[model samples]
Target: MTWRARLLALDGLTPQLGDADRLVWTTLADAPDGAELVFLGLDDGRPCFAAIPAAGDAAPRLANPQLWGLMARLPAADLALYGGARSLIDWHARHRFCAQCGGDTRLAKGGWQRDCGACGAQHFPRTDPVTIMLVEYRGRLLLGRGLGWGEGRYSALAGFVEPGESLEEAVAREVLEETGVTVPSATVRYIASQPWPFPSQLMIGCHVRASNDAITLDTTELADARWFSREDVATALAGKGPFTAPPQQAIAHHLLHWWLNQPATA
Candidate 1:
C-alpha cells in the first residue's frame, strides 16, 4: 500500500487527451442535468471528464448516498468529469450573490467564473484548504474517531486552515486542538494532496512528529483519539484488526500507508 504512484485517476489523463478544451466546452454545453462532470486537464484546451445521467430503464445507481464510498470504483472519466462538474456547479450554487455588494452574479468563463452585476466583481470557485496530518510519536501514529464518520471508522486529524496561518502552522495547531498532542514545527513533512469534493475541500496531507503520547480528545470534534503502531495499522488495513483503514481513495489512507511501509531512512 505504499505510494507507488499508480496512475491516479486524474493525473494519467492530463497528457493524452488531444484538443481537450474544445471537447470540454462542447461537453459542458450539452451536459445533462444529472450528469457528473469533473475537470480533467487541458489536452490542447481545457479538458473535462463527463458522466452521463441514467439512461432509460437504467436505475440511478450513482446517485445513491450509500454508494458514496464507491467513488474510486467509478471510471476515471466519470470521476474526473463528476468531480469537476460538481465543484463548478457547487461554486455557482453558493456564489449567487456578490460578497462585496450582495449583488447578483452571472456565470461566465465556460461555467468557471461569475461576474457581479452591481459591484463589478468577479467570483470564482473556492477550494477550502484543509490540513490532514498523521501525528507520529515514538512508534505510533494518531487517529481520531470523527463524530460525523460511521462507527468503528477512524481518520487522521484534520481541520480547516484558519486565516493568517501557514500549512505547517495549521498542522501543528490542528493536531494540538483536536487531540491535545503538540506537534513539533520542524518535523512536519508534506506527503500528498487530493481534491476532496464531499463538498469542496482540498486536502493537504502531512506527517508530523508528536511531542507527547497523552491524548485529550477535543470532545466537540472527536469522539476518541488514540495511537496505533505500524503493525496495528497494518492489520487494520488488512481487515483483521478491531479498527479499519480509511477509505482507499482518501489521501489519509495514502499518507498512513506511506508511513507504515517506508523503511527507516538515514
Candidate 2:
C-alpha cells in the first residue's frame, strides 16, 4: 500500500486476477541483503509471503508495477491479508530497538515478534483504536472536515481512543471535544468496526445521540462542521448535496448509509 497523509492510498502491490478481483501475488524476490520477508499465512493451502524492501536496497526491475485501482472494491479476505502484512512489516521496520531497555531487537516467530537481546524483552505489533462517530440530533447527522480537507467534503468526526476510556465514553468525549456537542455515554451505540492499515489502526464506528443541535467550533481540530438532515445526507450519498460523503471504502460511509436507512424514531 502507498499512502500520503493517511488518506490517499493506492494498493500498488495488488493486481487484478479476474473481473474486479484483486490478488496479492508478487514476483519480487528476497534480495539485495537485509530485506524483510513476512510469512503471511496460507492462501488456499498455499503459503503466502510479502517482501519489504530495506532502505537503499536494490530490487528486481519490473515493467508492470501491478498497480491496481482504489482498494475500496478489494475482496474482504484479500484486504485483510494486505492489512496484516502491511502492519507486521511496518512494525518490524519501525521497532528495531526495544523500548524497555533501548536494546537492538531481532525478528522471531516468523515475523510476528521482535526479541530484544540486550533487555530480554519481546514486542509485538500494536493496533491503535480510533472512534468514528455518527453524531445524530433529532433528525440530522453531524459531519466535520479537518483542516486542509477539500472544501465541501465532510465525513464523520473521529479521534483516537484515549487510555482508560470505554468505547462508549470515547465516542461521547470525541463528539463533545470536536464539536462541543454533548452526547452522554448512555446514548452512544456501537455500529461496526474496520481494520485501517494506514499505520495499523482499528476504526471503531459508533452512533451517538446529542441532546441538542448546537455547534461550537474547535478550530484546532476541525475546519468546519454542520448537522445535515436525512435528505441532505441521502443527497450527498447520491453525489449531489451541500457536502460530499466519504468514499465507499471507509467505514464512515457505511455508518452514514446505515443511519440513513433507519426509521426516523431511531
Candidate 3:
C-alpha cells in the first residue's frame, strides 16, 4: 500500500480549513511547487508535512482562518500540531539570513535547522523559556494586570528567563520585580508547563509562597497588583467576579486552577 504524504498549508499565519471547519492539509500532489515544507513525522504510516504557502493566496475551496480562533475549535491533537507548525514556520521566516557572515541560509534537518551558504554557521529553532508563577501569601493569591490589558483582567506574574538564571530564580525574581513580593527559593515549586506559540515560548508554571503581603507595584511592568482571597479566585475561575483570570488556553489558568484546589499548606 502506497501512503500519500499530507501538508498543512498556511497562508501567512492563517491555516486552511475545509467546508466542515476542519483543517484541510493538502496532499503532496495538491501542494504548490514552491511552498516551503517541513516534515512533521508519520501519522498512521502516512508522512505528514507542514507548509507555508509561497504566495499569500488562499485556495478557493478552503477558508483561511487565523490560528488563535482555531485553538478552542480544533481537537487537542490538532491544536498541538498547529502550535508546533507555527513555531517552526515563524523561526524559518526570521532566520533566513545568517548572522555570522550576512549570507543566505537554507532549511536543513527537515526544517529543524538552517545551514548558511557563505559561512559554516548552523542555526536551530529557538524556544524562549518563560517563568509564570502563582504567588500566594497567607490565604491570598497575587494577581496583576499589565498595562493596556484593560480593567478587570489579571493574571499570575510572568517574565522571560534571563541568560544565566534557573527557572526557580526566574520565578522568584519576576514576582519580586513586578509586585514587590518576595518568594523564597524553598517555597517555589514546579506545577505544570505549556507550550505557548505566540511566536515561540515554553511557559514554566510554578507555585510560589510569598514571604510578605504588602505590594509595591512596578508601574512600568504592571498597572496594578493586589492579593485576592481564595473565594475571589474561585469566583473568577467559575466565570464570575469583577476580575478575569487568563483564559483556558494559557498556563496561568491551569496554575490558578491547581492552586485553588490544593489543601491549605501552613
lDDT of 1 by residue, 1-266 (tens): 23211111221112112242211233354555554343334544435443322321122322444445445555566555555655555556566789999998776665667899997999888899999998888888899988766677787899999999999999999888888889887898999898876557899999888889888878998988888888888888888876777877678888878997776422
Which digits, one per residue and each the tens of the lDDT, describe model 2 over residues 1-266?
Answer: 32111111213233234455665354334223556566677655555666543421122311222322435567877667666766667667778889999999988877888899998899988999999999888888999988877789899999999999999988888888888899989988889999876667899999888997788989999999998999899999999977988977779899999998899854
Number of backbone collisions per candidate: 11, 0, 0
Question: Which candidate do you rate higher for lDDT, 2 or 3?
Answer: 3
lDDT over C-alpha atoms for residue 99 of model 2: 98
Whose TM-score is greatest here?
3
**C-alpha positional error of residue 10 in candidate 3 after TM-score superposition, expressed in Å:** 2.3
Write down the TM-score of every candidate.
0.76, 0.84, 0.89
Error of 3 at 233 (Å): 1.2
Judge candidate 2 at residue 247 and give its lDDT.
75
Which tens-of-lDDT digit does each residue in 1-266 have in candidate 3?
44888878566656666655667777876666776687888888888888654433233211332455666576677778888887788777777789898999888988889999888799998899999888888878889998877689899889999999988889888988988888897878999998977678898989888999989988999999988988899999999985897877778988888997899655
lDDT of each: 0.69, 0.75, 0.81
User: What ranking emerges by TM-score with the best candidate at the front?
Assistant: 3, 2, 1
